[model samples]
Each structure stands twice: as C-alpha cells, then as structure tokens.
Target chain A: MTTEPPPDAHAAFSAVALTAIDDVYRFARSLTRDEVDAEDVVQETYLRAFRSWHTFETGTDVRRWLFTIARNVFLRSREKGKREVTLDDDGAEIVDAALAREAWSRGGLDTILERADLGPAISTALAELPEPYRAVVVLVDLEDQSYESTAEVLEVPIGTVRSRLFRGRKLLQEKLMQHAIDSGLIPQPTAPVRSTE
Target chain B: MNHGHGSDDRTGAAAMDCAGAMDRLFDFLDGELGPETEVRIRQHLEKCGHCFDEAGFERRFLAAVQAARAAEVCPATLRARVRDALRHAGWTEAAGS
Candidate 1:
C-alpha cells in the first residue's frame, strides 16, 4: 500500500524560466517593433503557453512552435484593423499595395547603407529589408533555423522561403558593402576610370 | 565547372538562377554541398568575377550576421518584466494566489 503524499509546499508552477520568458519577449519584439505591443504579445503568448504546457509534446522544438503561435496572435491583432490607419504597414489587400507604392516612392531603401560600425548599419539594413523579407531574415539569418523549419513556422513553401532569403541577403550584402565604402572599411575606387589593365 | 577565363559560353555549363544560387550558397556555406557542385562553384568563381564576388560577399556577410546574432541578448529589465507579468497572470503558485 502506498502512503498518501502530503500537500507539497512547493509552488505548483515549474521554475520561473527566465531565459525562455526573455525569448518570448524578444520574439514578440522582433514580430512587432512597438515595445508596448511587444509586451502585450509576450504576456498573452506566455499565458497561452503556460495553460497548454501539458499538451506540448516532449522533444519538440518548443521555441519554434511558440514563435508560430506568437506570430499568429500578432497577425490576428493586425488583421483586426487599427482604429486609425498609421502611415506604416497595413497588410490588407488594397492597403498593402498602396503602402508599397508609398514605400517605393520615398526611395526608403535607395540610400546606400553607410558603413559606420557593423552594429548600427547592419541593424538599419536589416530593418530596411521590407515586410516579409525582414521576417525571413530574422528567422533564418538571425534565429538560425533550418529552411524547412522556417517555412513551416512562416507558413510559406520552401521555394518562397529560399527566394526571400536570397533576395534579402543579396540586398543586405550590397548595403553593407556600400557602408564599407563610405565608412572607409574598404578603400574607395582608385580614380573613377575603369581598370582594364 | 569550366574554369576557362576567356570563355563566353555558359549555356552547356552549369548555370543556376538567383534562387538556385541562393539555396546552394546557404547550403554551401553551411557545408552541405556535395563534392561535385562544390567543385563546380569553386571553378566557376575562379573565372566568373561576378559570381566570385557574390559568393565571397555572402560568406563574409553571414559571419557578420552571426556576430550580430551573438550580441542580441535581451535586456535584463525585459526578463524582470516577464516575471512580473507571469506573477500577474496567476501562472505561478505563490504568485498566483
């Protein structure tokens, strides 16, 4: 016969996952640039994750799945429509095309990335990579996920993922190289004459 | 795989689109390329200045991105905020009450 276990004084919750919590916040931050929005997203995501922890399968990549859910919540909030349309991104079918027009007309990305230090320039360049490209870059380049896994999370085909990643990287490289030129990281073209020698 | 510097014919040789090049580049950088394609790209680069620059630039750029990722640790205050939120959400026992 087994003795009835007395009520444990320990907290019912698992340990306060400091790192995991920070990751949720950061993932939220990456998804939404606004700090307040990010905080709200993080809070909601954690509440959901906590409530469903028992259902989360063992040996699965918890962080990746968590990111998918958080991204969904963020998108749902965006799809709910803003009270007043901000001058930034609104992904509705027609609105987004208009937004694209405005973004393109501003030549928002035409300025060559000035190579100051890798930190600031790279950050700015990364930010400049346009909507979905930016997300793919953050997930694959920054977050270090495999292509298939990233596609699964982003809900795009593997080909789409590859295309975006390649496009983003090519653009980013050009920006950084331009920065390098301006910042004197690389020597300027020696005399404008094309060297055929 | 042709390393003929003066050759203008890329038709019969292995040429890939931007998408394919990109996929191969990432996999190659990650050391996932087969020996054949790897050698082909290497020989291609030796003759094709543009592709050579593209490959070189991406290789260096990925390293920089890796370094950037290394430094992206979240703020300590961010963590504390999460903890506080968890407490408020009644996610912890003592804190839940």
Candidate 2:
C-alpha cells in the first residue's frame, strides 16, 4: 500500500506500492479531470516513486515529490498542447449561446450552473490563475486536501498556500461576477438577482 | 420574480435585498457553513429560487474547477506512449519529446 524504509524489506510497504493510489489518482483527476489521464499520471508517479524509492534518503515527503512529478507532467501537457485548447474566458458567453439555442432551454446560466456547464467559465478563470495558485486550488477546493497537505504537494510554505487561496478566491469572485453580469443572468445591481433571463 | 425580503426576520429587513443576499450567497452555497448555520442557510435556499439558483452557480463553478485544463486522456495509442515512458520509470520521459 505504502512504501516503508527498507531492510530493504517490509511486507506492508513491499507488497504493493499502491498505498496512496486513491489520493494520487484523485488529485491527478483534479489535475487532468479525465479518468484515463489521471490513471496515467498515477501510473507514472508510482513508477517514478518506486524507482527513486532508494534515493528517498529516509526523510523526504514522497507524496509531495511524487506530486511534483505529476504536476510536471501536467505542465508539460499544457505546454505541449496549449495551442489546441480553447483557454478562453468567454465560457459564460458559450453557456448563453447554448441556452439560447434550445427553444426549450428554460433555465439560463443558473440552470447551467446547476448542470455544471459553468465548468468552462471556472476552467477559464482557473487558467487565469498562476501556476502554484492554480495548483493549490486544484488540491484544495476540488480534491479537498488539507491545508498542510496542499503546502506539501506544492512544496511551498504553508503561508503561501493561504495567500494563494485567498487571492485565488478573490480573482474567481471578480471573474464570476463579471461573467454573471455580462451574460444577463444576474441583472445589473438595480435588478441584481431578479433580472429576466 | 420576488426580490423583496419577507417581514419575519430582523436581519432580513436591515440588510440588502436579493442582490445583497446573492453576494453572501456564494459562501453559503460553497458549503462553508457550520452545521447549525448551514441548516438555516439551506432552509432559506429551499424556499428562494434566486438563492437556489446561486447555489446552482456554485455547482457549475465546481464542475469548471474539476474540468478546467484537466488532462484529456490520450487515446489508446497515446496510452501506449505513456506506458512506454512508464516502463523506464526514473528515466522515463514521454515519447516524441
């Protein structure tokens, strides 16, 4: 399940290197959001961690190190494929366009929100989030890791995690608010929540 | 739809309307509430469409968070690439640079 320091021999750690699979895959899923991609990330992380298992030198936080590798894989993927992805923030606009198309589409972005079509908007805003902040958010909000665990995964100070999360939420709020207004889902302040869709 | 506050609660009257409620509403929907407080918030949401819709926004926001920039798992051929890289472990580098 987990790797233990060696006699180079411990049954528990030796049996299967899958102790952290669930955590690994879940965070990986949050990172890549595709089950198959996540499976690969986990597979890659495990193999790497296993190989480096000896050099682990007795005191390192393997999970964070493994996550660093996983994060790298993510970064590499983004860099390699950035040209292909949409990466735009007009997600709310897209939602509006989709809803408008459906003559039977009664609910607006709010309904979209219910259905999570707002994934695009959230994704757009997430793209706007800088690297470690974005990573921290993925670990915290989506994967629900504890604060210390996130700091470990990002290999940052605990304080950095707090600041990034705070700033990240502010940025998201501003972005989402702007989107809500522009799409006519939430009315201008005068009408606010009651505006007709 | 109705934006006006009802006459029952003291805080309801002193504060802003549905718009103002929407501002605090995201926190409510994010499930940040304490147990007792969450109950009250949910009760409010259960009755109000506007606040309920705001909750919907939080759900969609979560979905976006989940899907955002997430890896698109490559097809089986791509999987084989990863598998090949994985075979090498410590020296593993994805194929094709």
Candidate 3:
C-alpha cells in the first residue's frame, strides 16, 4: 500500500518556514541591497518553497534548504550581465596576522571602538562587497551559519566558502579602517612600519 | 609536527607561534578545531599577549557586524503579509481536505 504524508505536514512546514522568515529576509536584503527587491525575493522564495514543500527531506536542515531556494531565486531575478567578482589568487591570500596586530596596536582598535557608532558604515560596506564574498560573509558571519552549511547554500565547495569568508572579512576590516581614518578617529600611517626583527 | 617550542605547564604541549595560532584563530573561534588543536591555540593565547589581542580584535569585529545586521528587523507588516499570502494560496492547509 502507498503511504501519504501526514495531514499536518503543511502546518509543520508553515511553522518552520515562519521561524526562518526573518533570516530569509535578512539574507535577501543583503544580496538585493534594496528593500523592495529584497521583499520581492523573499516572497518569491517562500512561494516557491511552499509549492515544492514535498520535495524537502524531512530530517534535513530546513533553514539551509530555504537559503538555497532564496539564493536561486535571487540569482534568477538578478539582472543579466551583472558584473561577477572573479576569485583570483590575490583574493585568496591568507590575512596578514602580523600586520593586523601591528595595526591594532597602533591605536587602530581603540579608534574603531571609539567610533562605535559604525553601524551605518558597516552596513554600507557589507552591501558594497563583491557578491560571492558578500554571500559567504552574510551566511557565515551575519547568520552564524557553519562554513559547510554556507557552502551548501551557495552551491560551492567548502574551500571556496573558507576563502571567500576570509577575503570578505579582510575587505570589511579595511573598509572600517578607512572609515575611521576619514572620520578622524584614527590617523593615517605616513609610511609602513618596518618590523624591527 | 611539533614546532620545537617549550610546552605550557598547564596544557603540556608546545605553545603555538603567532603564525600558527593566527592561522587557526577563526577555526578556534568557530569551535571547528579538534580538541588538541584547540588546546594548543588556547595555551598560546593565554601565554602570548600579542596573539591574544589579535584574537580579541577579531571577536569584536565579528560582534560589530552581527550587531549591525541585528539592527535591521523584519517589519511586522511583511511577516503578516507573507503569512496571509501563504494561507490564501492554500499552502498553509492541505488541499481539499
């Protein structure tokens, strides 16, 4: 005999979908960078997910599945010929920890914390990041998703997720540093400091 | 391979250097490292001031980004609208039940 899904399957799907709605919207907003566009993407994602609800595996992660659907929707609706960020060798460079330490010690962290009202600056900087890097950062950093989960959402390898996240974070740090210097919270370095060794 | 460094009295392993510790900082912070590697990094952080400061800075930076994202809340109207639309589309209730 053929078996059918539970009668409350729709209710269960609705509950889980609603729970992830805010997160779904946030991800869309980060990608679309426009309120209207983000909302439209979110609505489309939910509608699509609802129609294909039966295809979702029961025990798997619902949020990740939703994110995958949302990402696909965003890509399809995005304008054609949009400039895609090329992940090059330079973009995969490991962050310079020593340089970062030196910068931090040179009143960098102090200046950043002092300019604690950097919410708008941070938001704008995130929105301006290259799409690949931005998506990884939003999923991994903003939403606290694991690198593995983010990879599944973006349909890329875990290595790609790791590299994109590292580069994205470095870019954001640089942007925040620039904002601090522009706001007079930190002074620009005249010449690079030579390591004393 | 061991880095030929002195072992920490508490953790009984050679402390990781700035480069090694920094390389694993994100993984350590994200709880993705193995227990032994995590202990090594933790021991290094406890003994080294510079690496400690760097890790602290990264943690704060992540917190700042999270705070910025948290500031943007999904409007109640949008939530209600999505819910209403789902119900209207008969996605909330089984069809012809």
Best by lDDT: 3
Q: What's the CA error at residue A46 for candidate 3, in Å? A: 0.4
* Model 1, position A147: C-alpha lDDT score: 71
Winning candidate number (TM-score):
3
**TM-scores for candidates 1 onward, in order:** 0.64, 0.44, 0.77
Q: What fraction of native interface contacts does model 2 preserve?
A: 0.23
**iRMS values for every prediction:** 8.0, 10.4, 5.8
Kindly list the per-residue Cα lDDT of model 2 for residues A1-197, writing each as its tens digit: 34333443223222333444544665576567566767777676766666556655445554555666676666566685363233223433433443343222223333444433455566555545544455677676665555666777666675576656654554554455446556665554442232112
DockQ-based CAPRI category assigned to the predicted complex of candidate 2: incorrect
RMSD of each: 10.4, 11.7, 7.0
Least accurate stretch of 10 residues (summed lDDT) in model 1 chain B? Answer: B1-10
For each candidate, the alpha-carbon lDDT, in order, equals: 0.57, 0.51, 0.72
Regions of model 1 farther than 4 Å from truth = A1-18, A21-26, A80-117, A178-197, B1-23, B30-53, B93-97
Q: Model 1: DockQ against the native?
A: 0.22
**Best of the candidates, DockQ:** 3
Which residue pairs overlap in candidate 1's backbone?
A115-A179
lDDT string for model 1 (B25-77, tens) is: 66666544555565566676666776666676566667667556644555667
Per-residue alpha-carbon lDDT of model 1 for A1-197, expressed as tens digits?
12221223114223433335545665666668667888777766766666555555656767786777777778777884343223222323323333334323222222322222576567656655555666777777777776777789878886677766765665565455445556655555443311110
| lDDT agreement of model 3 with the native | 0.72
Q: Can you write out model 3's per-residue Cα lDDT over A1-197, one digit (the tens) per residue?
A: 12233557777776677678888988998778789988888888888887777788878888889899988888788653254345544444423532454464445744575345877778777876656678889888888888778878888887687667877887677666666666666686664433311
